[model samples]
Target: MAAADREFSPASSIALTVGSALLWGVAHLATGRRRIGLTLLGSYALLVATILSMVTLVGSDLLTLAVQPGWLTALTFMLLAIAAAWTVVIVWSYVLVRPDSSHPGRRIATIVAAVLCGLVVVPTVYAARLASVSRDVVTSLFTPSSAPIIADDPWNGRPRVNFLLVGADSAPSRPGVRTDSMTVASVDVATGATTLLGLPRNLQNVPMPPGPARQRFPSGFTGEPPYTPGLLNEVFQYAEDYPEVVPGVRKGYRGPTLLKETVGGILGIRIHHYAMVDMAGFAQIIDAMGGVRITIKDPIVYGKYREGLLPSGTRKLSGEQALWYGRSRTDSDDYVRMGRQKCLLNAVAKQADPMTVLNSFESLANATKRAISTDLPQNLLPAMVELAQKIKDTRIRSLNFVPPLISTAYPDYEFIKRKVEQTLADRPVNKTATAPGSRPQSTPQQSPERPLTLDEACA
Candidate 1:
């Protein structure tokens, strides 16, 4: 009998080959592609081993980001595409090894292979579409501007990176934007320790350092009111309205640049970057996460001057309610609201674990993108991702130059600088909340400026 005739039918070959695809190389070995089969099997085995090892190493850090709605959405789509391509490649290789078969099953076998390939291709195309849509949403969310970036100094080699976080509130009806929340985050490069330095919006008489801005103000950015006009947050619009006042203000980023410089000088630390978000957008982000469920310690009012009151206890809050919860200055002061904001943050982080992000991926991504704007470049995203791993592992210490700590009215810049230095150097008193799950103390009842554990605050 001929060799071809001696071999089993095409059905047996197709069946066995299909089985080997699971192991990714068994089918090829059974069908006389020994060299290629072994090569694939070995390569796949090595890849699997390497991936397993990497997972073990990265571990919780991977979990931290993977659950994040923004990160997971992108990852899900990418994974689907890879899976689809891989399936097609495997099937094509199997087709090449099929035994010669004039048997009736040959056509059936070809049809089956085509069907399998189609299944993968369809999902791959769908995933690609989803990923593209998401990318568009993220790109469109922020109002792009020339960052007040110092040329050739990207903090690549620094032991620390600091950035200004501004909560910019601007409405169509309003003429100018107001920065309601302003906090500077200084991150330690080596250990991922983070220090949050909060600046009150009503701060006065901030000495403007020698720059293009000094020529105009000479002494400082004197607000229109001449005294209080130069509040920390007010400087943004001041710089924007009168861009010509600051000599070297970047074409479109005058306002942000000015604020960065003023904040940097006051804090006695160089502010390398800035990130801003609309308070309304922040509410949208909360709503997108399906409303953060939390134990509201007290009945908090919203909509300016006790316009509304959110009841206490464990309940879910809509975007508007959450926004009010964070920004409500009706019954409470700015510093008190700052504490509420921290509590909201802890609630969101605790509730929106990975599975939750996946479930609400679309809404969360849209809300966050619409709300957030930052000068931090896209190129640095990978680096940030790496740093986030370390950051999650390290304890985050916070210091707010609010209340008795530093007088916002008179304001001791010297004491503020020394405090910042000591905090960055790692203060023993502030050295708590040293876990990924831990949060900076900011409960409605507890002092917002101090670091209090969630348990302590809740208790």
Candidate 2:
């Protein structure tokens, strides 16, 4: 009898069928179904060509596609289509190679083929789900804004773009949000060199920009009765309480918008975008990223009774430990914590590898969506992703407005702005003064006239 028409044992039939299905068309040719085998091969070739064309058009960096919602949505549909085609091929392969009815183990081979089809379906479904989740997160977080746009220049020809990053101490248990940590990440549009301008949360009398907010806090942001000693951190809560004072600002976003304007006014630059993440949910994100390694200079005592302690030295901390490392204030002061916060930020940025992110993406996505809010326009994401890639390799500098540099109690706004300008103009240093891999030995006591790179500040 011809090999193609011969009845094989169930074991042989199963092996040949499943293996050929994986190879896309080899099983059909083995079973005298050359027509179907060739068709599948041709279809697969076309699919590959279409995918290659897409990659060519989208640019070589596939990771950048994740940030583009429109492209991601299309990718989701394509993934489903590919999965469906694979299923059809697998089924066809099974039908072509199933043992004859007289074969005792025919039932077993049929059951195995169904299982193989299911195996093919599983991972593709998971991938499609991940794509869908990514799309939703991007769409929700970066809603299209009615903000004005420049036709020719996406960045409006700005040399640098500033983003206000806020760590908000707010939860359902808390009445209002406090800006626990605020840093302005200023990035050079062309080079991706970054300057992290850290602001003290307790900065008193922060000047408001010229508008309704400025009109209300004309003599600087002193508090209304019962909320005296108004600090910069309370700006958000204050804005929330009196929405009329921030007319034209969106209702749910008045606080962040006001904070943005206030921060911009303080720094003497326009804050292009703002993103805030809840302090309470901060640990979740760190956990999702599989925790972070930080160089702690000294033992930190935290909690109500100094019950918690994080020992010093280079250590990989869990999410909760990292949170306390950056937020603890029992023996540590805010200024010291602020420096730690900068170190923590730098560590997370540098250590979060693409493989880790991809492996923990689902958990990371959920945690991020629940914890963060931003006013960054959706249309800007692709450009932002490109900039981020640049930042990974570029120099990063940090300057915090703390005691000795500028008093939080009574800051010289003009001096601060001049310092900002000088730091921005300062050329990159060729060598770092600190030892390689050394943590910030002392709280960043940056010179009033000199700029401090992040590597030097928190090496």
lDDT of 1 at 176: 84
In candidate 1, what are the lDDT values of residues 108-129, reduced to their tens digit? 7677666666666676666565
Off-target runs (Cα >4 Å) in candidate 1 are: 1-157, 226-229, 304-307, 350-352, 426-459
- Tens digit per residue, CA lDDT, model 2, 119-228: 87888888898899899889888888666655446687999999999998865665788899999999998899999999998888777778887788787888665645
TM per prediction: 0.71, 0.89
Model 2, TM vs. native: 0.89
For model 2, what is the C-alpha lDDT against the true structure? 0.81
Indicate which candidate wins on lDDT. 2
Output the worst ten-in-a-row residue range by lDDT, candidate 2: 428-437
Residue 1 local lDDT, model 2: 77
Tell me each candidate's RMSD, in Å, in order: 8.3, 5.9
